[model samples]
Target: MSNRAKLFGALSLGACLLWFRAAAEVPPETVGQVAELPPMAGAHWLWVPDRLFRHSILFDGDSGRMLGAIDSGVQITPKPPLWSHARKEIYNVDTIYSRGHRGERKDFVVIYDSRTLNVKGEVEVPPRAADTGTGIALVGLLDGDRFLVVLNQSPGTSVSVIDLENRRHVGEAQTAGCAGVFPAGPTRFGMLCGDGTALTVHLTENGELDRLARSKPFFDVIDDPVTEKGVRDGSTWWFASFEGLLYEVDFSGNAPAPKEPWPLFTENEIESGWRIGGAQHLAYHRKTKRLYSIVHEGGPGSHKDPGTEIWVYDVPSRNKIDTFSAPNLIAPFLGPQAGFDATGMLGSFLSFVLPNMGVHSLTVTQDERPLLFVRHSDLGAVGVLDALSGEHLRDIDEAGLSGALLVVP
Candidate 1:
């Protein structure tokens, strides 16, 4: 060999000798060891679905700490996780490809053990629920948590009912112009349509659709459209419109009963250009019978905009009782809630460069002492607030990207 080749060969041999020596010095680590999570409180756990990463992250609302997360599916569109306090389980409807991302697609429901957060079982369903966003109304539990109702919209619109006990798709209710799955009874659900009507579907005990009923159009579809993020109060469902109108529909009887619509904003508030927005996650406390919605100072056609404030209303009385400004969930490195603003390079970058997002989703616990959870979608942070007083309690950062919905158990 030449002189240059000999020099390189010696260097390579010396580097290999040093690597072997270092590897021999370090001990091997143990593997195949699994760990179980501790017991969690019923009302303290919050499920935040990260649509971008396609996973559902669990956080403790009391301490604002991330407990764990479960994968929703291999697909891009994510369905919000459903929690069953009765069965002590969590359910996620998903769609995955047979050969990674480009093969025969399989839509299914994944059951997870609430305590261990492990995969318990899975039920195969039709590929009907893969096109929906992470909306609270896209999925729900029926028949005492035995059946899972999934709203579908992929070129065609329908609701797929999955029998979790039998691990199969039970039935499909054709809701062509309708969207959302609001559980009205143990075996029935209501869906809001695009033509200003609602459909109530009653299912058999075997999880098959028995009959369907349609209610008269109560809200206008052309002028002011009611949002699909409707909240439930026993058998009554309250929906907010783009122009700050609350429409109530009762399903206590065999058919849906429509009640007169009420204005959520007063004369002065409407004049100042205030309307309801944030159609993904609206909070409703069962015990208090109050509905929480994100409100902002925007004119018409801005129903999907993010809101910097939250307004609470008494559903029974049809009156606005409380309104609170959304707190800054993201803490800047050197700005208003942290340091100076527009003073130096760091200050200017923190204040103007970075965007302080607003609340795009909301949820509240059902316990006696309730707490509200608000999500900043772009920031992937959550702000905890007192449900009764509307006071900012704490903020949780690094939650997850594209957290579209929040669920409390």
Candidate 2:
């Protein structure tokens, strides 16, 4: 071979080897990449990433100035997979978590002063064999020394009495089978049972278990009226279940039960080509009493009714006022493992993280302003949305943070 030909052949072989290396680096079936991590902790009181793990958030209504972040700490299980943290919600407290001692098999509800962000004290739920933690999704700060802890989970699938003054163990009473507990009136509580039932319970002045009432919650569908449910303005209880049925259960029982639940936009009306589950996302305007529920459609490789639509229902009339498609609503696209890239706020007014798009935490502020905060699961971003204008507000990216968003009052 000529010297020039030999040199050219050597260079071509080198180039081919480099190309092979590059091609081998990428698997043919590879589609997604390891996304960047979410925001870290420590910043203005604005939104602490560590503050939301398996927790919840609630804005103090009376003051309306401070915000609360609650989370239950990590628990021990037969395996790490079985260990799950208790969901904490911010109300008049911060750092309120249910710490489970694996050795002792006990779950203690710890409350922290939001201002100091310090552990105020702890309240132990009724002692159990399995160390079932505080499954309290919704905790209402009624006044000083009293708060309502709703446990929708086992061991504590009832109401927990917490005495802030003493800051110690208190009594617990079995409400309905499931958690979904909300306050209806002073000393009275509302709970949605897992058995497609809603019951009202009255409490003693000193925070003792009182009586239970069977409510005639208005709904259109009798076969399955209870879909997904929540309490509105602490006065009316709303449930979305069985197709697009949306029903409002008045705690006062002043309103008559509806022959059927008002339809929030049927699946056919939306042309979603999917069965829409009733209980998607339920959030109520604190003062206005307007209720919002996300009517979602699930896609392939997704849970049944993965939530493709958001429905808004009027409390007074029990009617569907508006509906938005899932695609239009911002949400993170999940990879095969059901994860997404950690994309920060696209813009100040755009979504930072999409709502879990499946039974996520989405709530509008009590103020007249239409600001709404939604917790997106794919990326674990807390999304802020403009409810009135239906615009995407900035998002607070808090993936791998300390807690999960509970409720925002």
Candidate 3:
């Protein structure tokens, strides 16, 4: 063969190899598009993904079937989706950036119909800072779902109140050094400050900040800071500290009144290094009046570690009623070893190498047969457990569901 012909053949072979390598790197497409499932009866579970994708998924609480999803588009951070039973609507707050300018950004609250999942309306507000570190209640509905409150943090912290009925931005409230929005009353909400106090903001019927009040120091800000993710039981808000102390605050009145703090762990348990930890560590069941917490054994700085056991408590009696192991404890390290010694050894090694799985968020179904929804961040699995009997019902595998906020409606 000629020298030029030999060189041409070598180039063609090189090109083929490059094409094969590129094809191998490409991810396989999903089998089919996610079809919109009909909304089933009973409470629906909505979870917001922390990473990988910018969308919230709605699943049937009873059947563990995915009903639909609210896609937030690419590279956008969304607040926890809010569901209004009265109006049958889903509200999402997210930030949008300009095409040319990096600094040009706007925050928008988009409304969606619950049944069809169609875009109903959208209102633009000031841009908000994206803080994914702490689990904060950044969005809330107030005044019978007529007004929507959103927390904003461009460089400083504040809140924007939007009139949902009119689809307009009403006003903004300054909440410096404080974070998160916890609904206090029909026209009021509270924000946890860095000074160990909660600042309450009262809004008018038009969604303007009417007045503001700050509670006295309740927890130690320097020593053990309380998480912003508080579980609301009626007008009472229960906040958990890093060291496993439960602080109760009554927001039923004009101001947020702090109650006495209670030890979540016994003396022996404290000595055994039990502490409140995880992405979302506390859940409250109103009907049962029980507070469920994800706990783990850790040192002083391990308050953010994953949990291994769930401790149930009766808040009224201030008694520990029951304790159960998390489903992660019994989850198979490897599926179907089937007499394969290598597979069995690999499973054992994985069980030892991986951290103990724990509950990131917990929620109870609103219907009669209350099922506890537990999000295990380590395994990326959501387990449905019987709330009363502590039985593991089933597990739903979803990628990037870790550190997700679980909302039921």
Return the top candidate by TM-score: 1
Instruction: Find the candidate with the highest lDDT and give its number.
Output: 1
**If both were scored by TM-score, which would come out higher, candidate 1 or candidate 3?**
1
Query: What RMSD does each model have against the real structure?
Result: 11.4, 13.1, 10.1
- For candidate 1, give the lDDT: 0.75
lDDT of 2 by residue, 80-171 (tens): 00000122222222221333323434455555544334455556664331222222234554423255453434555666666555565456
Backbone clashes counted, model 2? 36
For candidate 2, what's the RMSD?
A: 13.1
Q: Each candidate: what lDDT?
A: 0.75, 0.45, 0.71
With candidate 2 superimposed using the best TM-score fit, by how many Å does residue 226's alpha carbon deviate from the native?
2.1
Which pairs, if any, clash in model 1?
42-409
How many backbone clashes are present in model 1?
1
The per-residue C-alpha lDDT of model 2 at residue 38 equals 18
TM-score of 2: 0.62
